[model samples]
Target: MNAPARLRVAAGQATSVPRDVAANVATACSLVTTAADQGARVVVLPELFLTGYAAEEWRHDDSLALDASTGSGGPDERLRPLADLARERGVTVVASAAVRRALDASTLSAVVLTPDGEVRAPYDKQHLCGLEEQGFFTAGDHGATIVVDGWELGLGICYDGSFPEHAASAAAAGATAYLTPAAFFTGSDHRRDLYYAARAIDNGIYVVFAGLTGTCGASSFSGGSAVYDPEGRAVARTGADDPAVVVADLDIAEVRRVQDEVNTVARDRRDSLGHRERLEVGRAG
Candidate 1:
């Protein structure tokens, strides 16, 4: 199927009720409805939003993580509400949660809930931040892309977006946009501006960053959720520390324009992206 020439997307910034999956899901449903009403075909939510970004909470109480076993044909009961909402609203909802992939295994995963009521966790966060996350969640093996209305969106979570190779891999995989669900802290404005925009410009694709707001455990999130165009311009954005939803119409043609015409970064990116040689430059003594 041919991708849409222009696709409307949204980034959701909301507060997470610590250790409360049901409440968080309910909150996400409301935000999803808002985005759908705004004509967004896809809405991306914050990281670990299902049970909050409380890594210690997850570590202490494993029950907080939803069972997302690979063999399951449908979402678990806890995930059904959001799935039903997506189907009813005909919007693709990208949400994240701590998931138990197996009895002994758990990971922080971003799931794509399609309008057809299908749910898939195409990406598990590869880069875990700090000791809390590193001690609690298992890192994913690789990056992945999800399709909504024929628009390919590469998936990442928080720290994963900081790595240039992560977004570059998505572009190489034919993704027109990169979606990141994050929980950035209050003083990370410089990071929020640099990382998302850099990823968009570096890959010559749309970048949607959905961040958390308010407090989740010991940390306070700055909800600088935004959507950056291919040229790294902020097309849509929410105020820092504000709980809101921001939407933007991403023109796929603009991606082509930047990649092929204006920005050659995407077009000129070599396949040896993973290949790097350390070079030493010494001043002539």
Candidate 2:
């Protein structure tokens, strides 16, 4: 029997010390160490992880934003340490930070630090939540996808995963795995949990969610970090429980099994429904 493209992924769910990018990056580095120790090739973190998802505090701190130029950090340098850590640990790190698009524009973006320590193109969140105001952030025009070990991993931030159409666009473009880095709040758990799995089954792709867990004073997030299979099954999950690292081995060929049996994306559509008409269907990751 032929084996699938088995990628070991880790969703590192942990709390952050509000407004401290350096400290949060430290926490993420530690978690990445743990996940890497468990043999995870890819580690995806929560949304706005470097800033701890401090929301208004993050929005107000102009100094906290990352620039489009270099992947350095802090007044001295903080983010590069995480990339260095990823290189040392031999893991691909997907972590979010606020990006300064222009002098007047900024957006929440996921930066991939490869195992070789190269900074891939940043995946900016296209669908902004209420907090991402007009002047603060420039909404991204296109979705982002990265090819790793031959797997096309689609990128999405917290609120972006909630919409069916957003994920649909990525799937349309041949994304084998939708990796959502998010900070979902308390009441949003049930809906997000249900929707993440549905996105996997409905699209016949792997869905991996790495979300912020725990509370910061009055604010809190749904701590459920999870990974779902193409069959819409929970390969790994951590509910609103604790800061933990959940890892799963995704069988990429299942995309073919599910599609060959059901064939939703290829057979069920009418006119792409306002979406562009380029079919980039994946060959099982």
Which model scores highest in TM-score?
1
- In every candidate, how many clashes are there? 0, 2
lDDT of residue 54 for candidate 2 = 61
lDDT of 1 by residue, 88-163 (tens): 9999998887777776677888878888897777788999998988887889997888887788889999999899
lDDT of residue 235 for candidate 2: 89
Model 1: ten consecutive residues of lowest lDDT: 63-72
The TM-score measured for candidate 2 stands at 0.86
The CA lDDT of each predicted structure is 0.86, 0.78
Error of 2 at 218 (Å): 3.8
TM-score (C-alpha) between model 1 and the true structure: 0.92
Q: Which stretches of candidate 2 lie over 4 Å from their true place?
A: 1-4, 60-65, 69-76, 131-135, 263-266, 272-285
